[model samples]
Target: MLSFSRTRSPGRNTSPLAGGMDYLEPKRKSNVLGRLILIVSLTALCITMLKNAPSFTSPTSFSRSQEGVTHVLVTGGAGYIGSHAALRLLKDSYRVTIVDNLSRGNLGAVKVLQGLFPEAGRLQFIYADLGDAKAVILHIPKILLYEVDKIFSENAFDAVMHFAAVAYVGESTLDPLKYYHNITSNTLVVLEAVARHKVKKFIYSSTCATYGEPDKMPIVEVTPQVPINPYGKAKKMAEDMILDFSKNSDMAVMILRYFNVIGSDPEGRLGEAPKPELREHGRISGACFDAARGVIPGLQVKGTDYKTGDGTCVRDYIDVTDLVDAHVKALEKAKPRNVGIYNVGTGKGRSVKEFVEACKKATGVDIQVDFLPRRPGDYAEVYSDPAKILRDLNWSARFTNLQESLEVAWKWQKSHPHGYASS
Candidate 1:
C-alpha cells in the first residue's frame, strides 16, 4: 500500500494514483478544462451541502473564565492515526470531538470510540465537508466570529488538531494540483477556522515526505525540507501557514512528522485499513481485497537493492501504541514557543523483506511479494532520530520492534477483515 504520508513528485509520481484505488486515475488529473469542471462540481456540492443543515455564521462563545474540561476537536479523528490519538486524548481526560466525512474513515472504527466511551456521542461525528467553508462554519457553534472582518466573531475554541488531508504520493504525482488544492487550500480553511475561533492550541499531523530524499543518513528535525512530490508540497505549505498563524495569531502548535505507522490497537479493533485496498490472502486480507478491486497489483514489493543489509528499502516502523503516546505527551509538553516539530518514530529501521518475513512468521502464512521497480517518491533508507522527543517529553517507544507491531496488526486485521464494514 502506498503510505499516505505526503510524498512529492519529482515531476512524475510512479506510485499508484487516486488513493491508489486500481486504475481509476484518468478522471483525477485535471487540466484547465478539468478545472472548469471541478469548479462546477464544487459549486454543485456546495449547494447540496446547504440542504444538510441550517446556515450558521460562526462558533459559540464561552466566557474567558469558563474552566470546564478542555475540549479537543480532532478533524479526521477517525483516520488510522487520528483514531488512536482521539482514544488517547479521551483516556487522558480531554473531551474530544471527531469530525470526519467518512470519505476515508470507517464507521466501524468510529463505533470503537463509542465502545470505549459509552458517551461516544460526546465525541462529535460531524458529517460536514471541509471544502465547503460555509458548511464547516455551520458545524461550529454560532459563537466563533471572523477574526479580521468580524463577520462571524462570536466563536471561541480551546484547541484543534488538523489531520484531514489527501495523503497519497502517487495520486499527487498524477494530479499535483488536486493534492495541493485539497491539502493546502483546505488547510488554510482549517487554520482560518481556528484563528477565527481564537483557538489556543493546534496540532498538525504531518509526514517525512517534506524532507524528500535528503543527503544525510538520519533525518533530523532541522534538515532542509525539499519535498519532491505535491503531497509533500501541500504539507510544507500547511506547516508554513501554521507557523505564520502562530506568529501572527498566537496559536500554539505541534507538527508531528509521522514515520511508517504499523500495528493495530491491541483489542483486534483497528489497524491499517483503507476502504479500497483489501488483501484477499494473509494478514492484509484488506490489501488483498484491493487487489481484487484492482486498485493495486497483488503485493507489490518496491526495490530491494539499497546499501542496507537486506538490500531493500529500510524505514522506521513505529507501533500505533507508541505513536499515540507521543501525541499524548505533546499535549502536556506544550512549550512557551507555541510551535514545535517532532519526528515520531521508533528510530529503528527495518527492511521491506524483513517486514514480510516477520509477517509470514507471525501470521503463519507465506505471503506473496511481487517485487516491482522502485516506486516514485520512495526513499531507499530512512529512519528517525527520536532523541529530541524522548529528551524533551520523556516519551520513549514502548513497543520496541516490528514483531510487536505485527502481532497487533495481524490480530486487528483478522478481527476486522472488512474493516469498519465488519461491524
Candidate 2:
C-alpha cells in the first residue's frame, strides 16, 4: 500500500515467493537437524535395549555372554534335596540360580553352598514363593521387583529343576489344602513359567508317595498312580499337568519319583535341617538325629503293625547324594518332547526297626524307640524298581549301605547339633 518494499536491497529477495523461501530456510534446516538428533537418540536407545535384553530365540539359545554355560534354575533350593542338587550342579561347573521361599527350607543350606561356590556367576539365590498364582515378586538387590515371568524373561534358563513342595505325609492328611496349593498349584506355576520361557529340560522332584500303597513290591514307572494322601495326590496331579503340557511342547521332561531320601552332603557342607516345629511330621532320618541328640525324648516309631518283615512300614532309603546324582543324569539324558518317569531308590526296602538299628549304629547311641499305632495315610510298604532309570539314564543308587549313609549324616549332626544354628 505504501510501496515500502518497492526498492530491493542487494542481499534481499525482490519476489514475494523468494522472500518467503528465504524466511523458511533457517526453520527448515532447524527442523531437519532436530529430526536427525531424535533419530540418533532413538538409535542409541534401541541399541542399548538390544544389548540388555535376554536372548530367547530357542530352548537351548543362550546369550553370547554366557556361551557354553548351561544355566539351571533350582526351585526350593534351600531345602534338603534341592540344596544337594544345587551343590551338585555347581560342582559340575554349571551356572545355578536357586529360588526358595524358606517356608520349610533352611537358608543355612543355601549359605553353605554360597560359601563353597564363592566364585561369581557360579551361584545365586532368590527367595520366592511359587504357591502364589499371581506375580511371585522376588526381592533382590539392584532389581526392586521381579515376578516369576520377569525371572524367566531376564535370565535365560536352559532348564528348571523343581523341588519345591510340602512333603510331610501326616501333615498333608491334616491339612490337605496346604499340600494341594503348595505341591500341585505351585508346580503349575513353575510349569507355566517353564513352558512360556521355552525351557528345554525339566527335572521334577517327585515323591514315591504318588504310588500310594501299591500292591506290588518295587513300584515301576508304569505302575498306577493311585495316591492315598493329599501329598501324594497333589504330586500326582502335578505330574499329570506336566505330562499333558509336554505333549505339545518341545520340553524334555524327567519326573523323578523319589523314595525315602536320607543322609546329607558327604563333605559335611550341607544336611537335613528341618524346623523344630516340623520334626513331628518330618522324615525318619531327622527324627533319628533328634533322638540321638536328645532333642526329643525318644524316637516314636509311627507304625509297627504293618504287614512287613519287621511288623513295621517298609521304605526304600535313598541317600541324598545318590538322589541328586540321579537328577543330574536325568537332566543329561533328557530328550526334547519326550517325558521320562523314573522311580529313584535303592530297589531295597528297610523297615522302621531296621532303620532304627542302623541309626543307632551310626550315632553310637541306643536310641529309645517307642512303638506307636499306624498314623493316618500311612503305607505298609513303598519302594522303587529303579530299573527304568538304570536302563535309560544309566543311574543307580551308589550309597546302598544304610548304615554308611546314616553315618555320614550322623557325623554332620554331631558336629552341628543344632543343625544350621551350630554353624
Candidate 3:
C-alpha cells in the first residue's frame, strides 16, 4: 500500500525545437521555409479549436444560499475522509451539499452522517460523477449562464473540497492511464467548474505519497516531490494544475498533503469502510479490521527487511478527525489570491508490527500474521514535520493515540460488521 499525503517533466516551458532552431539559424542562409511551416501549423490549430468550441462551452448552473448558513460543496462526501469533513462542517453551522457518484462511497455512510445531524438541516447529498460535467451540472439548480463560456458563475459556490478519485496505488501502478483519468482529468473538470463559478476557496485532498521516498525522516512542505507510483504522480499533476489555476484566478487554494490516515471517527458516527469485495488491501488498519471480523483469512505483513528499528516500514498515522479539523481551519483561512500547502500528520512514526499489536489490543482478538517479502515501492520509513500546519492553522493531532483510534475503529466494525449492510 502506498502512503497518502500523496513530477515535473524537464523543459516544459520552452519548446524542444526552439534552441535547435536558433542553433541552426546561422547554418541556414534562408529561413522562409521554417516561418511558413509555423504559420501553417498555427492556422490548422486555430481551425480545430474553433470547430470544437461549442463542446467546451457547455452551460451549467447551481445556487443555494440561506440566511444564516455558509454553503459548501464536498465532493466524495460519502467516503471515509470526506464524510468526516462534511460532518464537521455541518456541526460548525455550515450548510453542506455532498456530491458523490457512490462508486466507492456507500449510501449507508451518507445515511449515518444524516442521522448524526437530523435536526440541523445542514447536510444534503447529490449523487453525481465528478468526471461527467453534464452530470454535475444537472444536479445543480439553474439560475445563471453564458453562451459558449464554460463559466460557473451560476453555481454560487463559496468553496469546494474535492476528494472524489480512485486512491489505490497498486491499481494506479497496474494502469497509469486509469489513475490519470480518474485523478488528473477529473480534477481539471472540477477546476474548470470552480473557475467558471468564481468560487474562491478550494481545498484539495492531497496525499503524502507525493513526497515519494524522501531521504529525510520528517518531510516538510519544501521537500522535493519525486513520486514513485502512478497514484502519487496523478495527485502531483492535480496539485500542479490547481496551483497554476490559482495564479491567474481569484481562487484561494490549500493543498493538504496527508500522511497515513487511519482510524474511524472517534464518535463512531463514521469510519473507514470501503466495500469489502472492492476494497484496496494496502491499508494496515483496514487489514486489521478484516482480520478481526474474519473477513479475510488473516493479515499479511509485507516487507520485514527494512532499515527501521523493527526492520519494517514505518509511517505517521493521523486520526481522521484531526485531518478534517485541518480542512475546516484551512477553509476559514482561505482568502482571495492566496495559495497554501501544508503537511498533515502526527509528526511521529509507527512500524507495521506496532500498529498490528495496537489493533490486537483494541479488538482483544489474536491477529494472525504472515511475514512476506517487501511489496514494490514500499519505503523504509516516512513521517511528517507538521510544525507548519500547527503554527499556521493552530491545529495538531488530538486523537492520534494509536490504541484509542483502533478502539473506535473496532467499535465501528463491530456495529456495522458488513459496513452499512449491517445497519
Task: Give me candidate 3's TM-score against the actual structure.
Answer: 0.80
Superposed by TM-score, candidate 3 places the C-alpha of residue 11 at a distance from the truth, in angstroms, of: 85
Which residue pairs clash within candidate 2?
Answer: none
lDDT of 3 by residue, 1-423 (tens): 877430223423335655633333333535777788899999999988986795444432234455555678898999888998998998898878788889888899899878876764467777766664454378742221231122234345688999888887667777788789789988887887787667768999999989899988789999999999899999999999999888898788999999888888777778777876655445788888898888887899889999999998999999988899999999998878999899999999999999999999999989899999987666788899999998988988998799988898889889988788888
Q: Is candidate 1 or candidate 3 better by lDDT?
A: 3
What is the alpha-carbon lDDT for the whole of candidate 2?
0.87
What's the count of clashing pairs in each model shown? 33, 0, 12
Least well predicted 10-residue stretch by lDDT in candidate 3 = 142-151
lDDT of 2 at 322: 95
**Per-residue alpha-carbon lDDT of model 1 for 151-242, expressed as tens digits?**
21322346777787767676677778877766888788777877666777888889988888788868889989999878898899989988
Q: Can you give the lDDT of residue 220 in candidate 3?
A: 96
- True-vs-predicted CA distance for residue 96, candidate 1, Å: 0.9
Judging by TM-score against the true structure, name the best candidate: 2
Considering lDDT, where higher is better, how would the candidates rank from best to worst? Answer: 2, 3, 1
**C-alpha RMSD by candidate, in order:** 22.7, 6.4, 20.8
TM-score of each: 0.75, 0.83, 0.80
- Global lDDT scores for all candidate models: 0.70, 0.87, 0.82
Candidate 2 residue 25 Cα shift, in angstroms, is 28
